[model samples]
Target: MNLVSKNWEYLKIVTDIPKDYWSTKNEVVLEKENLKLRRFKNKSKSSNNAVLILPPQAGHSSNICDYAPDQSLVRLLLSYGLQVYATDWQSARLNQADLSIEDHINLTDDAVEKIREETGLDSITLIGQCQGGWQASVYTSLYQDKISKLVVAASPIDFYAERDFMNDYVDDYPMEFFEWLVKLGGGVMKGDFILKGFKSYDPYQHYIKKYQDLWKMILEDDKEGIERYKRFYNWYEYTQDLPGKFYLEVVEKIFKKNGMINPGTIVINNTSVDLSNITCPLFLLAGEKDNITPPRQCLEMANHVGTPKENIVQVTTKGGHIGTLTGSSALKKHWPKVVEFIENYSQTA
Candidate 1:
């Protein structure tokens, strides 16, 4: 096609992309003020095991867990015969701006109880991704008995494990600067503002390089590549506002204070979030190239958890932060092993 035709096609593809997407079919099993617990429909025979997925609450939709038919984490686990459920976190509105981190934790506990009640199992496997990972860790630490197995993928348990952009950015800025942004949003932290910080991590990639690649694809008439680009940005570009209190706590407790690594630093419901309380079989998944949460940030959990060294498993993939969770290679080569680990322990459940 001519240059004009290629440019028109590119514009059409970009404009036609949906605002959001979820590849798998699911129903809301439970809904709370802040989230909805969704249970995916599984066509295969179910197993004795059930797993709850906690998608990252970082300014984006929980649909990341079920990104697409070919790259969904939910579908992969379902293929392994385990029942799957995920927390669909809602964007914070003005009223929800006062919600705290403890609120989220309590909600997670309620979701866990609902899963147990439905499955008729005393304990179920819990898998948390990115921000959800630390939340899962705190919950497992508090209620170790509820979780038969725990997997924290690309989570930052030890915020000081590596000196990366996030750590530096939080350290360099005054707390007031962040607070001011939240104030501007009328109590909630606007998702677009948070997304700007993320994009600042690599402005060229988020701004220039992606568009350049799209243009190249348009020039080559690479329909498949254009489709992939459209799908990824449809999810990536969509943003979600967060409760001001919740956002501040995460920045202060988890990132600034390195709360998870330091026992009793983070407390919930009059209980301290001590990682040593988690004694179940633990699996830690990390991406070697993940600047957001480096491998050590995730792998270092083994040092703090009460689980025996023999019971702990750590797998490192070559992909970056988001890719580790949704990349095809990770889905094919690594996630199966994760599911197998859960299944092996499920025999005892």
Candidate 2:
């Protein structure tokens, strides 16, 4: 086809890209400020050890865990016959710009309690990924008895770790810089800003390589590849605004001050958070190739949690940041290990 024809066809394909389509096999049990708890349909024989999946709220939708049937962590958990629950944090809006870290943690607490009351399970296993991982740790520490087991995947804990590029990047900016940036958004952090930051981590992949791949698919007329790319890319292209206060606080406390592990450094609702209070069976999953939150960052939490060393399991699997979380191959190998670990500690009434 001629250049004009090819360009027009490309425009048509791009315009026809389906809306951010994320299929959920679960039902929304609770909804609060863009945060909702979802439970799979087969609750007939729920396990005493229910699983709660929390995807990072850093711009991307929670659908990352439920990206597709084959790439879904939700499907994997359901297949094991375990009662599964997840947090679906909606996009932040201008009116919700003042939401803070405490707000998120508190809402999560509400979700957890609701899950317990409904399921009659005393405690549930918490699975946190990336940003959610740290949030889970904080919640588990403050409410130790509410959780039976803890799993954090590809999450950053030790912010001061020498090899952490994210930490270094955060250090490069002053807190005031972030404050001003948030101000530009009128108190809400623009999702595109966050997207730009993520893309900045790897300009080639976000800016150049993806389009090259798309062009190749177009040229080769690879229908399957085209469909797969569209499915993943549409969701990726969709960004969510973040409450400015929460965004800045995370940049300050988690990334700048490294308060998560340090006692007296972080507090929630007037109560101090101490990671040592977490005595539950802890499982830390990291990606060996994950530069975003290197294995060191994810594994170091095991040292802080008071769980016996014998109760802690750390696995460094394959893939980079997003790959570790959603990569089909990594999920196939790493998630089964997680299921096995949770089973070991599960208790039924």
Candidate 3:
């Protein structure tokens, strides 16, 4: 192809994903700042027993929990005859860069209260994925009565329990490194940079393997594989900003300080967050292949929550971080176990 044709093709390839791309699969019942609570249609008879799902707002779109019809956590819950609600965490903007951990926790608390009132259910099941797991755990610890069953999938509770290149990278740099990053982003940490940092986790995947696979797919005329790649790439490349305050707090408090494991060490909104305060039945899921938040980080919560051993269930599934929640094999193997636990603790009509 000529230079002009190639440039035109490149222009066509530059896809656009809106800021509100994380908008829910169902009805958006409430929206505030960078937080949105969504309610999905219920086909189950036990719709009264509502469950609220929170997706990680790290850098990618919140739609990771419900990426497609077949790969939807919401759909799986609906199939089990359970009412489902999710938090669509909107992207942080430059002006909102100062938003803090307290802000996110408060917003989540607001969503939980709203879900409770809207459904008229005294308590709802809370399920969180990755970063959402941290948010959900803190929320449940603060308001145990509002949540009947707590589920955290692929979340890191004990940051110090495991070490990886990413963790070491952060540790090698002083807090000033993050400060400089925030300043470079004009007070907000650009999602593109965050995505780049994540890509560095496995440079082979980002730098070489992905493009090579794409080229192979093109040569083989694998339309289906190419379409799947496009879909995942669309979501992956479309990143969002994070409040500098929130980002720093996560690094300082959660990662550097290792707050979650040490009970009563972390304080939020005038209350010390103790995992032991969480008395509700707990369900913790971990991915064996997840290097980001290893199984140990997630499963240790079982030992912390005040819930009895019988009330705490932990499952280690096969797949990496993202695949644990959305992988096809995970949907068949790991997810059903989660639903079963939720159903047992969940209230019914």
Candidate 4:
């Protein structure tokens, strides 16, 4: 927090990973000017089938593979000899002020097509992590033929279930206050806004985590632990604002209106995306403790799919929101199972 400490703090944030931990030469693709695309591969020449990964909200290229550190899901996929490609969302700024849900869907579709062209593969599999799942669902509905198979992980589709934490927050919003934030931040959500939203669920939890980790860092003089803390802090403390229009639409459609699962009330580009439009084999992974997206919400999504209902598979992993992505279940159980499920299906398919 002091002069020397503060500058060192920034260095710690960027330096944790050793250079070798990252895969060499990720092929870059562009869905649009605003949406940056990159591919992570384990082999020089790869299979026709590759997993298109969409990271959780606020994630970037580093989320998929940390070359400096020997950890990440991309690493897991590479170890299995499978190819992985991920999307890197541009941070919100004044210029991207008019971005909407349609833009996301279109950009992703563009990315899919680009991947297909680059690999010369007629078909490709899809994996959506968290809100990325929502985007994937929309894209699949819009371009049903392009996607061969779909996997939605830790995703919430029901939108309006009373128990969902995010829905509840949206429902209680003072429209004026939320709108004020949009106007102030160029129609994007601030990182602090999301952090405060998370804190609302359990205010002291994050603080406690910092304190506990700080105590360990100080007592043991653990440079590695201290360094990791700084790196995560840079990401955690750095807030990216989201376009107001998209945020409003998300509230109007997915949260307040809860339109994704029910009626066609939530209009995207004058067309309603019925859940029935999803006819591809779908795999949904839900965290039993995920209040942000309770398991029931995702299950309802499977109910509306036009495909054989039996083709929809659900894996109930144990963890809360992000934990579902990175905790014991992710590192130990869920990630492995997820890879196997997708790989087996893609191979047999």
Check candidate 4 and list the clashing pairs: 17-68, 18-68, 21-67, 22-67, 187-243, 187-244, 188-242, 189-241, 189-242
What would the TM-scores of all predictions be? Answer: 0.96, 0.93, 0.92, 0.85
By lDDT: ranked, best first: 1, 2, 3, 4
Model 1: how far is 56 from its true place, Å?
0.4
Residue-level lDDT tens digits of model 4 in 259-332: 77765765567778877888878888888888777877776678777767667778888787666765544656
Q: Which numbered prediction scores highest in lDDT against the true structure?
A: 1
Query: On TM-score, who's better, 3 or 4?
Result: 3
Candidate 1, poorest ten consecutive residues by summed lDDT = 11-20
lDDT of 4: 0.68
Task: Give the Å error, residue 322, model 2.
Answer: 1.4
Q: Residue 7 of model 4: what lDDT?
A: 42
What does candidate 2 score on TM?
Answer: 0.93
lDDT of each: 0.90, 0.84, 0.82, 0.68
Per-model C-alpha RMSD: 1.7, 2.6, 3.2, 4.0
Task: Give the Cα RMSD of candidate 3.
Answer: 3.2
Please give the distance, in angstroms, between residue 310's alpha carbon in candidate 4 and its true position after superposition. 1.8
